[model samples]
Target chain A: MSKESIILLLFIMVLFIIGGCQTQELNESGVVAGLGIDLEEEELQVSMQMARPALPGQSSGSEPAFEVVSAKGRSLSEGLRKITLLFPRNPLVAQANLLVIGEELAKTDLALIADSILRNPSIRKNAVVVVAREVSPKDVLNTQVAMESLSATAIPRMLRNQERQMGIYQEVSLEEFLNKLARPGVDPTAPAVTLIDSINGKAIRLEGTAVFKGREMAGYLDSRESRGLRFLNPGRIQGGLINIPAPFEGPGRVGIEIIRSQTKVEAANTDGQIVMRITYIGEGNYYEQTGEADILRLENIPVLESICAEQIKSDMQACIKQAQKLKSDIFGWGNIVYSQHPAVWAELGPDWEEIFPGVKTEIKVEFELRRTYVTDQSLHYQ
Target chain B: MLGSCYDLHEINDAAIAQNFSLDLLENGQVAFLAQTTQPVPRSETGETQPSQNISVMGTGRTAAEAARGMFLHFSRLFLWIHANTLFIGENLARQDLTLISDFLMRNRNLRFQTCVYLVCGVSIQDIHKAMNERGFAITSARGITQQIETQAEELGYYTPLANIELLERMLTPGIEPALPQLTVIKEGDKDRIVLQGMGVIKNNRLIGKLNPEQSQGYYYLQSKKKQGGLISIAWSDSPNAMAVMHCTQFTSNTRPFIQEGKLNMKIDIKCELQYLETIGDDNIYVPANQQRLEYLAEEKIKQQVRSCIIQAQQLNSDILGWGLTTARYQPGWWEDMAAQWDQVFPVVGSQVEVECILCSDGLSRESFRFN
Candidate 1:
């Protein structure tokens, strides 16, 4: 090689060496799938749930069969740093799927918890957030799942299932919470998680939603009200069963798994009271049929429709009753007044909770079963 | 030889390709809306001058009007970023409004005029129609409930204030007749619908009148193949019992644009369900006695299914999303309809076709009991 060529080759080698040394890994490492934040006395406690690689002979049947570590510090970030101090592996959260706040932590100053989560660069803004109700969030994070290996993945999936099947607490991610923390008249909700232990085994149960009027916890909606909140806030996608009464089968019911649902909220001025109208359209499949009535009959559809309406009404009532009793705005009632009818909201003044209790809400639902996969309209008996 | 060498060097320099910077095609008028610390003054000579930098207040008519103006003014800035743009931000924070609005207005020469967001107190749908009057594009935010709450918190007004109390405390009765504020009163079966964005159904059909909650459920069950969520259910062990629950999260990852010709909204839901906080039994079996588990499962699912569908229905209107759907689904429509989206949303046609497949019957199916 020529002398100049030799020099160029050396320069190129140096560039490659520098590039290799500076390159960062794109994949998440030592990522804890689930994390729990709790406050004890004056210290902040952080619990992390991470999935460890299984041994060659180890089975991956029991999910969240990983490792859990915890530490306490003056702050959430400090607590997290303490975790890294104890473990050789660097903690990562870019792929974290859930963040659980202990019930006590959620009550007073959530802004501190929210700020720490928002400031983290590796944390995903879309990660689901929740409030632990029945027990410490760490317990729920440590619960074993039969399918997924990480409780982080399992917990989020379980919550997502609730959204699809039943619109309860509308899903709120870290990014979403930040945005809600900035609005003028609306609030946000995060689902509550609890660890359920029974003779059968252990499972993570969805309790209800935690309501935040702003950055502060206003109150919590009971599960039924959470259902109403879900119905009122259809932006979340939920899948679940809706049952209707069957006339021919006495007290028997027919179950349909909801494939899709949407809601329209209207705030209007009528007379002197604030009138809120919530109209919804739902579509689902007749997943299970136990009654004598034929599923294929077009005429029977109307009868089924009537039954469905009654069911929805009762469901909505259950939600409304809970919200009213609790004096919480999990359904975004304040939002409706503030955004749609600001003028009225302005007049209602400071006692929104008091007015909320008396505010009239009318829920209207529309259910349609557009298709039935069954080919035969009637079961033929020879 | 020296002359030739110099010529060669010049030729090499001239041969370098010129970098191409794509410029946006300029079109339409730009309007500025912002909440300023000082009121804008119109000159006696009929001259309009941009006055005082707007602080972007959370409330007040000036703030609302200014935010609306700034959004229109900043349309150009967004157009520059996305040359063939439709929707822009789904839900921008209140603090960021001033910057974004300023950016949009400064780029007045851009092709598109719409700067759609999930929730921008002001509507851009009408501006698009007036300017482009042609086809347009749109964008949206996935989960927006948090956005609304965040906006309020950012503005320093997180709590829901009782309007009457505030007004009563602020102004004495002698001042101005407290304007008769518009309110929605619902008594018994009647709900006074406000905001033309509201939709009503009766017996599962679009019967002009606002259907009762029960009727609305019937409409959803009859029209769609799937119920969105379960709101209430009876434990298989106790057929007469009911539990109220809610979904905390709902999300869908179906990009219908890539998979199918139809524009589909994907959904996944998570809920916190409550039923008589004290459950007599957590593990209740279906088919309590001499009956199939499927029989009870069917009944329990149908009852609360309709209730969950309502949330979905409201979202489809593009109102709940902070106008994100309008920004995504119909950018062109949003541009044309931005001004009146609030009014038009209620009357907008909402059709969501569904297909639900049950994957599990829980422990009830396996442990169903029959006498």
Candidate 2:
């Protein structure tokens, strides 16, 4: 053959090779919707939840669904490999909406668990991190959702709701918790989740929060205190209120909540005292109505003011008391002291826990009930 | 082309051989006047222009000796800047005349820079005047103060999310109480000596000036408990007033080990005065019901304050001065205390007591009963 013909033959071969690789299915795969991490006693537990595609024009509806697979090994990567054995096709990459940690495993040791998270490149740092407070994380992941096609998509929407609400329940991003674990002054807190079983069977429930001081389970802030505990950073929340029945109207009570808060802390003497204040503005909606007094009466305003003050005082005290009991300055008090009165904090030395319980508090709260939300003093009066 | 090449070599040789001369301002110190980033036309000789604005702090005997302290201080600041590079660049890249006052307090070596402190020492009016003279718009820069937001995406430490606002990271303190850990108390009366350094901050700066009376007020404000014979005054009550003006109804339960059902918190509190202003006939008279109100306010105040303190404990927020209290009371407590403080605070068993002192409401308490 002539040299020109040989060159043309090579070009034709190149076209044939390119054509062989042109199908869209060969390049793109699938997306994962949810992930579950469990500790299998002696080995690592890993699970993946993916949204399966629906059949077109089938006799039955395509109703959204997902398949659950389990893998176990000494390490997360190895566990993933074991799980892959159960699937025919490769797991497609998609938005991972939720990550669930089993209660039994979460309580055992978090350091290794966190390491697995750090190593997984597919795992998103901001994926909702929840610890199964009572039920197994795998069980929580298994629950079916009626609204959404897949539980993977449904679970995250639930967590995101809580995130938008009061924002005290920290989202516990993998990166943030890890950063906090490494810092001495700062500690980590994760949302506690549980599977609740009613007459209808199991459902997901947000328990409260798990406080971690230095990568160890320090303690927990119950639901009420957790509401206030979450106020420490506010994270993504704009502002929220904790409705405590205000002591204004007789019988029925008004709902009072803090609309905004600001905190300042400092140390005075070397290792001596740290003074902090949660300066907040309280706003509320009236849940109670009484006929004897007008809600708009200026004289009644004092009653409303006192109710607001007491509520704030209670919230602030609950936060402090919890910090003292847990011995973990999860509120970043150590950082406050160090930043404000480093000299004094230094004198106290390394053991800040001992120095924390005896600490005194100076709290100041300001309240403004923007509106009564209604004009009528009472349902009976109206 | 040959001639040009020969000339280029001569120029390079001359630049390498010539010794740079300098006449630095010698004020017996090392002043690091930041070189303006603007480029200046080289003198006909193409020599670099000298700056006369750098004023660095120095503690050494010689100019070179002083350079070490200045450099050390700057090094610390540089590290902070490096750690928060993105935050700084996003927030303060445009702001001129950076004041390093609070920064100096943390690093005492920069005490000489106090005169240059801007946010606190200089009044807003003064700042306005200076800015006018400098031909800079007050609201020109887009700072966090202007952009109120809730969500912030992390773009390597600094997000466009309000770095100049709530989390501006200003290297100074603000108007609220400094962190009350190290209080400087001076003994005096009506025209009193100021007590500084509670370390309370507002807007990222320290405003540490508390009079003895205000200190007592601060204590009362935190405690929510009234002490015997301590007078409080509230002139006109408004909902928007600071905590200093509001009355509080304090409640608490101090039973030991009450974590389960019917967990009782020994609670008591009633509305009591939080502020005072000595005025004419419309004023709250100190002697009117002094004896009776004093007794009532004591327990009530204590309960209110304790509730606040306890709530901080419950949330593990540490809003109270417990760390300092422990540090002062039990300095070596952390050796064993640190391990248990978190668990101990929420369940600390103690006697709960409260009382409500009724001050003659200028508006009159009888008004509530009649209305």
The candidate that wins on lDDT is: 1
Cα misplacement distance, residue B64 of candidate 1 (Å): 50
Cα displacement (angstroms), candidate 2, residue B189, comes to 86
TM-score of 2: 0.45
Question: Model 1: runs farther than 4 Å from truth?
Answer: A1-29, A54-65, A165-170, A198-200, A213-223, A234-238, A291-297, A346-351, A375-382, B1-371
Question: Candidate 2: what is its chain A TM-score?
Answer: 0.80
- Which 10-residue window in model 1 chain B sums to the lowest lDDT? B15-24
- Alpha-carbon interface RMSD for all candidates, in angstroms: 30.4, 30.0
lDDT of 2 by residue, B175-228 (tens): 011222111122342111111212223222332333233333234433322222
- Writing each residue's lDDT as its tens digit, candidate 2 over A24-80 gives 362244456777777777777877776666443221233336767777788767876
Determine the backbone clash count of candidate 2: 96
Model 1 interface RMSD over true interface Cα atoms: 30.4
Tens digits of per-residue lDDT for model 1 on B1-371?
66434212222111111000111112211222221111223555555443222111111111112222221111111112223222211122212222122223223323222222221222333222222211111111111223223422231111111222222212221111010011123446443311111122111112121123433233223211122333344555566544333322222221112123223333322222212121344434333421332333334333333332444344322212323455565565556656664455444333333322233343234332344
| Number of the top TM-score candidate | 1
